[model samples]
Every structure is written in C-alpha cells, then in structure tokens.
Target: MTINSAHRFEPGATVVRRDIFGDRVWTAAPRRVIEDRGDTLTLAHWPGVEGLAPTTYIDSLGMDSPAARDAARDQGFADLASGAWELGSWRWRDTTVLSRFQAGEHFSVHLFFGAGHRPLHWYINFELPFRRTALGIDTRDLLLDLLVEPDLSAHTWKDEDEYAQGRRLGIIDDALHAQVELARERALELLAERQETFPTSWLNWQPATDWPLPELPSFNGV
Candidate 1:
C-alpha cells in the first residue's frame, strides 16, 4: 500500500466516476475527505448534496424532465442493460456517512445511517479498485453488492439479479466476474469474522456542523 499523503485528495472536494471504457457515470457532490492515506481513502457525503448523473434512461429523456426521472426510478435496471445512456442529475438523500476504499481492492466499504441519522449498516460495493485521477477517482460500478449489519452479525448479497443481467448483457465479462467473485469472498470474511470496516469509534462519528452540502461543478472529470 502506498503511504503518501501528498497524492491524496484535499478535504471537501468533489469526485467523479468513470466506467472501464472511460465513460462518465456520475459525479458525486462535494464529499469531505475524512482521510486520504494513499492506501486507504475515506470520504463522507451528507444529505442535500447534489451530484450529476451520467445516465441516459430508456424513456428518451436526457434526465432533465420529471418524467424521465420517474422512469429511471421505475425501470432503471432495464435501462442499464440497454447500454444507451447519457448525462443526468441526482441528489443524495440517503444517510451515506463514510465511504472507504482500500488500495487495489476490488470493493469499497460505506457506512450508512438510518432514520434520525442513526447507525444502520455497512454497504460493500463491488467495483473496480479506484485509480486516482486529477479530478477525483476513476472506476465504475459492478452489479453485485453486499449489506452487513452494523455489528457484522448478519449479511446479505444484493443486486444478484442485476448482476446476472449484467453478465447476460456482456457488461461484466469473465475477467471482471472473476475479480468480483474474489471480492465477494473477501467481503464475506469480514462479515463472518465480525470485522467492521473501521474501528468502533467511526460507527458513532457524526458529520461536522460546518460541512455544507456539496454541489457538483461538472460531471465529466476523470
């Protein structure tokens, strides 16, 4: 793991995501760089922060119309399978407290809060390990995911159907699927061993009062 601080992102900077093909996916709202140790990058995103989505839904909408947004909410999986998408917009409404990625790991761990901002669960997102970029990070979403209880007492796989669909659509090739499967096992070990992503102190951590809701300046950055 690289242990350089100079190569890390500054606090309160926005980041963007790109597919393996280098196509824009979505740019996050301003996220607080909780820690950027080169080996492990931790970030935080609070509610009300607005981000740009690079999705071209199947409704023939460019993501500006309410109807398009509604359609995306309804049949997003189908649209993703089509592979004919474009730029759109979305706002953070969930309790995404902390997002941490280990260097060269094929997955990331995110802590989320529930109603009233209470500690909820840890979300393990399976994707390409992030490569640092000038604007932020470069990576794309894999269809598979895992959800673990806050105490790591229970866990479940998510988006199985979506993952299968991705395979059928040739979105996740054999090479990528191999990596995803390995990541799944590693994430499961963390759960079965009751190993939380971060120390217990992080479970109770709260957002700073001064952290403003971040806005996205652009979504095309690498």
Candidate 2:
C-alpha cells in the first residue's frame, strides 16, 4: 500500500539530519543528476573522474529482474540515493539517506517493484567513508551490483514546463513533511525500545518551497 493519504510532496530539495554520537550529521548528497549520451554533464557522483565504475559499493535493490535492470540502465551511473523500490505489483518505496558521519558522504536504502510492480528488489546503499572499516555484510550493496557499477541520479525535471515545475516543486515540500512525521514516529519507537538511543538525531527539514535556494544550504549540497 502506497501511503497515498500522506500529502504529496513537491519535487525539489529537502534537508534532513540525524545526530550521531554527539555529532550533527548533515546530508550533502546531490539530488539532481544531468546525463547526456553516457556523459553526466553536472553533479557527477564520482566527480573529477570519467566513466569510473562503482568499485567499492553495493546495491540493496535486487538487480536480477529485467525491469530493474532496465531502470538501472536509464538511471545511468550515480550513487543509489536510498531505499526506493516497488514490492510486488502494488507497493513502492524508496529512501536515500546521505550522512557525513557514516562515510563523510552519502548512503542510501532503496526498495522497489520489478516487472509486474511487485516486490522484485528491496535494498539499501552504504556510502562508506574512505578509511572506514567494513563490518558486517551490508545487504544494500549486494543486491544492485553497486560495487562493480557506479549509480546515477535522474534529471527528469530539467526541461519541465512551468506548471509541471510548480507541481514538481510542491512534491518536495510534501516529501519533507512526510519524512519528518515518519522520522518522529520511528524515533519514538526506537526510544521506547531503548533509552540509550535518546538524543536522537534531529534536523531542521525545510523544502525548497519555503525559501530561496541560498537560504537552505543543506538541500543545496547534495
């Protein structure tokens, strides 16, 4: 069941942060990726490099499905933002959480549907820091072949018309609200489970719709 009842978010930038070990972890991952003929002209995930494949990452999303493979092809090469995927033919969920604490960069967890829109691939992304040690096997990377291939973002809204742009922008705001509510609920649950998890990471989530681009540096970074 897609949380259709939740407010629809305007497509744009959203800033969310969670505290980790007294350090404030801000999300700096880019939300947009422009690709032209296999060449990403803007915001390269693996910047300063050309056509470099993903060598040390994993895709939690199952890539075995033909449809998933096709979608991956369309996305080009960018870090898998988060966990976004469809479950069977009726459910779809994808989330990307970029943390400077985890890897001094970004990491994601995605879950999506396959050919029939059913649960075909459900996974995560672990953008580990350069010098961080690998602990347990992260399932996010194993599903999407992230190690061998770099992930890419989508520039679908670049040429959108004014009305379409407005709509897209609106989605981003809605998404922020949804994220906040979701996070709050989860945080509470976690707190109940263990008080040690207190002082849960808190972030000032503000979508692009609220203010000018410059005012929100969190959204502008990544």
Q: Write down the RMSD of all candidates, one decimal each.
A: 4.2, 20.4
Candidate 1 lDDT over 1-222, as tens digits, reads 655444577666655434544353533445667777678888888777766554533233546777767566445545455644455566677675788888788998898986777889888999888887665676778878888777777788898977887788777889989999898888877766666465677778888888777555553333
**Among all candidates shown, the one with the greatest lDDT:** 1
What TM-score, computed on C-alpha atoms, does each candidate reach? 0.81, 0.20
Report the Cα lDDT for candidate 2. 0.25
Window of ten residues with lowest summed lDDT in model 2: 133-142
Q: For residues 1-222, write the lDDT of model 2, one tens digit per residue.
A: 122212221233222221111121222122222211111111112111111122211132456676766455334222222222211111113322112222222233223223333332322232221221111111111111121111112112111232233234342245443543453354334334643221122122112233322111222211
- Which residue pairs show collisions in model 1? 56-85, 56-86
Assess each prediction's global lDDT (C-alpha) against the native: 0.70, 0.25
Q: Kindly provide the TM-score of model 1 when superposed on the true structure, using C-alpha atoms.
A: 0.81
| lDDT (C-alpha) at residue 159 in model 1 | 80
Off by over 4 Å in 2: 1-100, 103-124, 130-204, 208-222
